[model samples]
Target: MPKPPGKPRPNSRPYTPQRLLSLAVHHEVRRKTQALSAFKDAEDQRPPPEPQLPADAQAQRHEPAAYARRLAMPHEQSWGGISPFAKDYARIVHSSAFRRLQGKTQLIPAGENEVFRTRLTHSLEVADIASRIASTLNHGSGAALGGYRINNDIVACASLLHDLGHPPFGHSGEEVLNERMRDYGGFEGNAQTLRIVTSLESRLGLIEDRAAAEFAIAQAEERPRGMNLTAGTLAAVLKYPYQLGATGRKAGRGAVAGKGIYEEEMPVLHALQALGLGLSPQRRTLECQIMDIADDIAYSAYDLEDTLEAGIVTPLDLVAPDDDLLEAIRSEEGVRACLGPLAGDMHRANTRIVDALTQVFASLFDLGDAYPQIQTDSVEGNRARHIFVARTYLESVMHARHPMVRRQFLEALIERHIAAITLVADADAPHFSRVSVEPGSRLRIECLKAFNYHRVINSRRLKMYHYRSRKILGELFDTLFDNAMERDPKIRGLLLPDRMHEQFRAQGRSQRREAARLVADHLSSLTDSEALRLHAQLTSGQSATFNTYWR
Candidate 1:
């Protein structure tokens, strides 16, 4: 009996190593080498390799794998469409864009605390948490998706690659880059992540092969770069399904409203939805839900962890007020203002955050696979109440809401700390601002995000740091470009020092974007100390002079 026309085959085999290797080699030969070098670097540093089966286990490894197996296979079976999820995952994991995250800051500066996380670590944690949530949800005994074959690979890959598009210096860098590129429609990390996965990740022939040459020719007449993934994966990776201006908000909507996929990526996104969601322009899929929940779980807990490790506010600091301070300020107004009276209150507030999270974990674990529909409406209501309740405690007594509190503990500990350290701003800015639950939520989130910017990011220290960094990167680019200018003698060639300059130069007018991208790529790959040192050397200008140890 033949399978129905539209449905996938019941069992499809995983792509053989020979097939995958062939695909990889073909793509490698065609790729711009510099970009491929960065991709290879990332591939080289993937935690540790997953265990491989012995030669005798080939039969077991070759068993048919399905759900979205065709998308993962190196060889094409029928037409052009490959799974979007697979492409997104591969794009994120393999691209230079993802590797640059390691050098980027998260909360504090990259060099601040050894244990404190950078953006790369934070993203990895988020991916892990998201993967767990998706796995539990998919495998859970919930009626929501009982009979469907949930792809674990899709969830894991999507979750891991989600943050690949963040710029340097964490949110601060993101803002500056967005402001700089506003004409390019302003960069959002999430939107950039989408762009990288769908379009920019294919510098090498990783997608183009002898088998795919004809397809590439057709596409070359269109867009040069694309992941060419299945629609299902693309839709799943998209948390916001609408474009920036596509929808009007209904009355009483919350922060979730006005969220949609970016307008620029619509063609690819729409193509993905049409295939995966089985809806034209209107509907979303189950995988999107998993991605969303995973994101939330990761953001809340990971931020808290980063805060703790940085020692900004401790469990003890929140719970206990200073007795000496209270005694010193004895007037009624002074006493009222003193935090000594709020020690117990802070303790309770901290407990609430822990309790709510504990409940979520318990609900996840105890439900033992039957947890997805466990009266989550009521549970979610309770969770929301707790979130507000805990926040209120911080607001009322301990003033734990201050950005300084969190910054103190961050590796980069932005300007919020400098103000506290310098006593420049009233220490209460972090406390005075309530978490806004406004429409678009961007403004409110920006407030928390902005505090970091106004204080630390734009602070003289960080600016100096960036200025120095830009100088070093600029010099490196100059040296490389000068070499190219002198040696290659190309008229009107750009001067960026990337591994792939030759290929970029070959492209002619498209060279500027490629140049900037290369610069971004090189700078993004440096560690904080490495960048600073390099900058120092570049500015020194002499050849290993008295002050000339590698910038």
Candidate 2:
């Protein structure tokens, strides 16, 4: 070891391995030398386009993977030539990975209560909102988009496909995978989404054609193009334009933090950028921006409905929430950006945020005009009210109106967001349009979105679930990863699914990154119930024999 040229400062801190590892977390090149959980999800947290190689530099031998045009196994080019984006839409919705979203968590875990929105339902809502936003802009500001119209089908595909890569158990499950893959390329939902679409999709045709399946098995080292989507649709689905190992990434914070792409997929992204959007890495496609905001809008409005119905939160709670809660909401990741300069002014920010949210929250319930005013603030006062049978009966009717009132409120909120969406032309990127939400509308959206944080995401109630997610994913990753690392196909084969085991064996012992990725893909594909059942079988030797219906 050598000292620096500069004189050492008297107050300089000692460089322990932990201290160096902590700092190296931000430096991608240096962090590769160390393997620790602390380096988990180190990111710049910027939504799109980190510094990228010149468009030409990214051309890959795997260029055919981006579209259906030049695949070893080609699928239909168009869905009956219905629309330019129609084929991609069919590919997305038809993928088994997309269907598995029904079993994945969105805000709440799936199967807890069938009424709550799973990732599938949330994606559907986001697609609807994104399509509506596209339509709104097309009708209102189409002329402003420099003659290029926003396509509803593209936005729908992008929105529906966005969450396909999310691991089971929601973000907590994602965090666990990210931690396990810290020394690998790092795990992120978006990056995994790309991986799924490009390589890991379970093709149904292969199962029926034994010869095709054997051919796939023989060529396991050469990754298959999953859906073989058009370059334009691929570009539209990329919410974040950066990859994990980009030279520009640095540790930072956001509401959500994870990799956008892996090194394996960068060449495809580069080729797509050259062929499709051609915008700088700093900018996203017009449709991608619409899908991104639609995701936010869906999360903000729909999750609130779920929470209120579950009794985890109430309309009154948002109308007049605690000052601490308001501050906490404003403090959430990516939320301060919605506030502009007002973010720094805590007093003004809280007041304005609450004022905006109140109007939206206040409409979620209705006291029927026929019902006498009831005291709901206190149980004792409510007990006195119950003694008045007329009042009790009227209170039931008033509360009954909430089911319909909330539906109308939900409709109104979705409509408000759609109307506020407009295309703002960017001078820096005239080739593209920037999707802008009216500032006030954006503020209200952020304020509502933050509730998922205050009452659900960051709440103590989910601690056990988080703990379970970490335990299950950690052990699952290690079991599969260690099996692959040992250079024994039989050992890896027993633990991993047949496809992943072969993928790992094909990579051999030298391609540790590829091997680890196979493990990750296998784990990430498991639905919540599958993960739980697999965990039980792997750890306790007990199985869900009665419920394994296909057997």
Candidate 3:
């Protein structure tokens, strides 16, 4: 299917009123006072002192009635779909998925950088940027696309919750978990976020009878509950909506690699389609386009920045011309023969890619009511003109030689190093290999992505850490399972709760696997020091000395 109406040009198009209107209602907010009445009634009808709070903290905050009032009164883009925006807001803000992001790593592990971003902090920044971009477009005053406005709430919520489903240990953790869970459908961070908002987050009884339907949990454990969020928000969250089964691409192909939502969550994914916005399968709405772009912008820029600040990469190394090395390699007749005519294109493509990203950042936040009018009359045409200027500006400064270039450039080098190392003779292997400069277009992009991920992400030190952490996790799981399996009855009581025990006994193998997973989850959630201390105590019989204070 084609895109939704009123598609803004990426990063540079003027914001129209319709875009603003879409932003306003995209998530469809409901008043907590109204929606929670039912949840509250449900809570009150039960006994006192429930383990959960009287109301869901996140849910209560996005009440639709209050949102409606806000829209009715004022804000950007007074459009047709503010309700959907509200729905998205509530689903995201109140969900456990959002909370878990606090624990997930952004650059370093969560514990190492409390002040720096975790995934949650990153998401909030993306949402803020996306909303501002959408708002800028919608704030246009006139008959020109008057009703078109981006729903800021939906954008905010979508951006915030985008990383909600990422497993612990950042990308490395995701890799390990995805490999382990492939049979259940491969794990992708984006897909997990979808699952969490729709299902996994625990929701206790709190709303009233009438309001219950609004926030009713999906009956099936595998399905998405009605975050009761708008279709627009849901659509925007899905950067890739096609499931692995449906995607025609091969298993490890980059496109299909991250394709599907978990099978269990299919029902809720379908429900979002059925009940909320009427988007076609595997397609995104216009609002989703904005959100997705915003995500990319944030991912590329912020992650790069973090890698630099950590003293991992230097910008100077990236920008400095490789003329001497190129000349030396060319003079070596064997190396020259191997490189052939491919060297120039390789350099050019790499340069273009970096230039493209730089341009995106320079122009991204340049628009808005507050910024000065910097208009350009381009003989080449508007979009082309914008893109050229952006690329030029970004290439100039982002790659400019500076004292801290190492901070910036180290990531790319790491990626390149990984790319070079992973190449094996096998074509269909599970692992990726580096490409030489001679690869075709499709293969080249694949190489670039692989190289990028390897250098910046899978550094040796980081991989070593992942290996160590995985070992720690294995030890923790073995300890938990060996001790608790028909041994410590009290611990068994917790693991095999009344409702969970019969199911456990019936599917013994599955139960064992799930028990291991639960233990792994608990282990991954620990801070670095927590994991180390716990491991030491478990092995050496050391006690936590601070327990006396509690006593």
Model 2 vs truth, CA RMSD:
16.0
Best by TM-score: 2
Steric overlap count per candidate? 30, 1, 72
Off by over 4 Å in 3: 1-84, 87-91, 94-96, 140-146, 204-206, 210-228, 249-255, 276-282, 321-344, 351-452, 473-551
Per-residue CA lDDT of candidate 1, range 1-551, in tens?
Answer: 11112222246333344554555565556553533322121112112122233445333221112223222123233323434345446656666666666777766677676666676777676666546544554354233332343455566666666666665556545555444334434446676667666665553233222323323333432454545444445555666555543445521122233344455677765554344344322333444444554454344444554544444533333233244322222222312232235423645433332332233222212322433333356977567656654654444234234445344433232212112111011122211111112221222122223223333445465676666544554555555434343434363333333324555556654434444444443444455555556555655763434432221
Off by over 4 Å in 1: 1-75, 78-96, 111-114, 139-141, 203-229, 242-264, 276-284, 317-493, 497-551
Q: Give the per-residue lDDT digits (tens) of candidate 2, residues 1-551.
A: 11111222245443433543433343433434543333223123222112132334334221122332323232221123243357568768888899999999887768899988999999998998888887888788746654555667777888988999999999889999988888889998988998888777733221212222223332432556677666656777776666675534341222134546887788777776565456345577777888999998988888888776766665666766787888898896556887778889998888888877786855433444433434555676566556655554444344334667667777798898888877777544433677888888888888888877776776676767778888988898887677777855567545676555555565555367777887888889889998888778778969656443231
Clashing pairs in 2: 49-281
Listed per candidate, the RMSD to the true structure in angstroms reads: 17.0, 16.0, 17.5
Indicate the residue-level lDDT of 391 in model 3.
Answer: 57
Each candidate structure's TM-score, on Cα atoms with residue i matched to residue i, is: 0.51, 0.75, 0.56
Name the candidate that leads on lDDT: 2
Q: What is the alpha-carbon lDDT for the whole of candidate 3?
A: 0.47
Write candidate 3's Cα lDDT for 280-351 as tens digits.
Answer: 443455456556655644555556566555555434323332454333333433333333464356565445
Model 1's TM-score against the true structure: 0.51
The model with the greater TM-score, 2 or 3, is 2
